[model samples]
Target: MSEGISVVRVTSADLPPLHGQRFDQAIAEGRHGEMRWLAEKADRRQSPKAIWPDAKSVLVCGLNYGPDSDPRATLGMGNTATISVYARNRDYHDVFKGALKRTGQWLASRYGAGVKVFVDTAPVLEKPLAQQAGLGWQGKHTNLVSRSFGSWLFLGEIFTTLDLPPDPPEFDHCGSCRRCLDACPTGAIDAPYRLDARRCISYLTIEHGGPIRRDLRPLMGNRIYGCDDCLAACPWNRFAKAGQELKLQARDDLRAPKLRELAGLDDPGFRALFSGSPIKRIGRDRFVRNVLIAIGNSGERGFLDVVATLLDDTAPVVRGAAVWALRRLAEPAQAAAERARRLPGEADATVRAEWTEAMD
Candidate 1:
C-alpha cells in the first residue's frame, strides 16, 4: 500500500518468549503498580496461541500520531498541565479502531480467512509483534521506533487463520544514544529498555490509584497525565511529522491547560471536558489528584485558592493530593493553621500520611 500505513506479518511463534518472561518478572517485582489487569489476564497476554489456537499469522499495522511541535517544550510550563502528545488528541483506541476494521475486512475478503483485530485493550504484546513484523525496532525507550515514523506510531494487529509472508524484522538502531534513558524525569527508564512502571509519571498519574511516592512528586514536575521525556529525546523522531488524521490531531483545549483552571473542575465538569479523550478513563478523582500534583509542583502563589477548594474533596485521594498542594503553596504560619484545622478530621491513614509528609 502506498498510504502511510503499512502492514507486516509474523507468526504467533515468532512473538518473542522474553516478552512474556519480562511481564512475569515485572509482576513479580511489583513494578506494574495498581494496573492489576496486566497480571490478571497474563496467561492470555503471554502468547498469541493462548488467545486463539487456530491463528497462524498476525498482521501488525501502525499509524503515525506524531506531534507537530516538540512535546517536551511544555515541561517547563509549571503553572500548566502537560498532557502527553497522544492523549492531547482523541483516544487512539477509538480513532485507530476504524482504520483497523476496514483494513481487516479488506484482507479477509481477499485472502478468504477469518480475522480478529486488536489495539491497546487486547492482551497482545503489540510492540514486540510490531518489531517482529518489521514495523520498527523497540528502541532503548522501550517504544517502537520506525525509520519512517520514529516513536510516534500507534500499533494494532490482526490475527488470522491464513498464513502470510513475514517481513524481515527490524534490528536495534540505538547504538550509543542514551538520550531517552537520561531524559526520564523520574528515572523510570532505569536502564536500556527496562522501565520500572512504579517510577513512571504515566503510571503514577493514570494507573496507580494512590498518593504518588513523596520522593518522586517533585521530579514529576507538571506532567498531569503521561510523561514523554524519554520518547521526545529519541533522535529517531526527527523524521516524525504531524499526524494527518484529523480526529487524532491535538485539540486546542488540551494542549497546555493551566493547572489552576484544571484544579477547579467538578465531577461533571471534568467528565464533560474530557468526554472523548482517554484522560476521562481515570475519572474525576484521579484526574484532579494529578492536577493537584501539578499544582504542588507549580510553586505558583496564584493556585492557592484553587487548591483550597479541593481540600475537602469527596475522594480521599483527591483530598490528600490537595493537602500536598496547599502545603507547597502556603507560608509557614498559614500551613500550620491549615494543618491544625484538617489533621484531626482526616479519616484515611493514607491522607493523614500526606499531612505528616507535608511537615517533612
Candidate 2:
C-alpha cells in the first residue's frame, strides 16, 4: 500500500547544495512573486536539517490524486468555470496529513523514533526532497512527474530520527519535449524548468490577493481557481491511472461549476458551498474576484446584469472585478452609464481606478 515511500539522509552535505542554490536563485530573482512565505523560510525549505537538527532521515510519501478525465475539457465551456484538478475535492492538506499522522504514530510506537509530519503546511521543499527520494523527477513544469502516476502526486513527509536507507534520486526524463511550456495560457513557464509566478494563472488567482493584472486576465479564460494546463499537457500522463482514493475524487458540483452560480455566492453561501473544499480558504471576496475575471473572459452578454449587480458589492476587490467584467460584456453606452452613475459615489481609490480602467 505504501510503494511510494522513500528515505533520505539529511546529514549528507552534498544532497542539498544544488537545491539550495536554485531555491536561493529563484527567491533572489523574485520568481515566487507575492508568495512572501517562500522567502520567509528559505533556510528551512532548502535543508531538512534546518527544520529539526535531531532528524537524521526523512520519509517522503507520494499519493496519487489523478483526475479521472482530462481537466482541461471545461476551458471551452465559457460559462462554466475550470477549477484546478487538486482542488476539485477535499483539501489535500487535511487528507494527506491524516495518513501521515497515523504513520508517524505507528513509527513512534514501533521504533521509538520521534517524528514530525509535514503536508504543504510547513516550509519543507517537498519537490526537491521527493526528487531526491526517487519519487519522480521535477519535470519542465517544475512539478514532480512520476512514470507511474504522471503529474498527479500529492506529497507528504515524516521527519524521523531513524536512519533509514536512502533511495537513489530520479533523473530528468523531459527529453526535448516542450509541450508543457507551450501549453501555458499566460506563458508563466517562460523557460523549461523555470517559472515566473507573476504571470502564472495559478498564482494570479490563488496567491495574489489584489486585482489581477489587466493583460493576464483575458488569457486566464474560465480558470477561476487554479490552473492545470501545464500538468495536463504532459505526455507522460498516458501511462497514468485514475486515483483510487475516493475522497480525493472530483465532486459532481465542482466538476464544471457555472460562472453565474459562482458569481452569486455571498460570504456565508461561499463558506457553506466550499466547507470541506480548499477553495473556501480564499474567502468569498477573493474567490468572487476570480469569478468576475472569468466572467469577463467569458464575454457572454447574459452575465452583464450579474456583473452590474456586483458593482455595488461591499468588497472593494469584488466591485473592482465587477467593473472589469461589466466592461467586457456591456455595450459602450451601457458601460458609460454605469461609470457615470457609480464613479461619483465610489470611495475606494482602487475601485475608482478600476472604473476608469474599464473606460479605457
In model 2, what lDDT does residue 160 have?
90
User: All predictions: root-mean-square deviation over Cα?
Assistant: 1.7, 2.0
Q: Against the hidden reference, what TM-scores do the models get?
A: 0.95, 0.96
Model 2 reaches what TM-score against the true structure? 0.96
Q: For residues 1-360, what per-residue lDDT tens digits would candidate 2 score against the true structure?
A: 443332222322124688888988999999999999999999877688888888878888878888999999999687999999999889988887888888888889999999999988788877888888888889999999988889989988888988877777788999999999999999999999999999999999999999899899999999999999999999999988887777789999999999999999988899999999999988999999999999998868999889989999999999999999988898999999999999999999999999999888
Model 2 residue 71 lDDT score: 97
What is the lDDT for 225 in model 2?
92
* lDDT digits (tens) for residues 1-360 of candidate 1: 524354454645346678899888888888887888888988787788788888888888888888989887778687778999999868888878777788778878987888898888678888888887888888888889988888888888888888777777888899999999999988898889888889999889888887888889889889999988988888988877778878878999888888878888888999889888999999999988998888888888888888878888889999999888888889978877888999999999998988887887
lDDT (Cα, 0-100) at 334 in candidate 2 = 96
In model 1, what lDDT does residue 224 have? 92
- What local distance difference test score does each model get? 0.84, 0.88
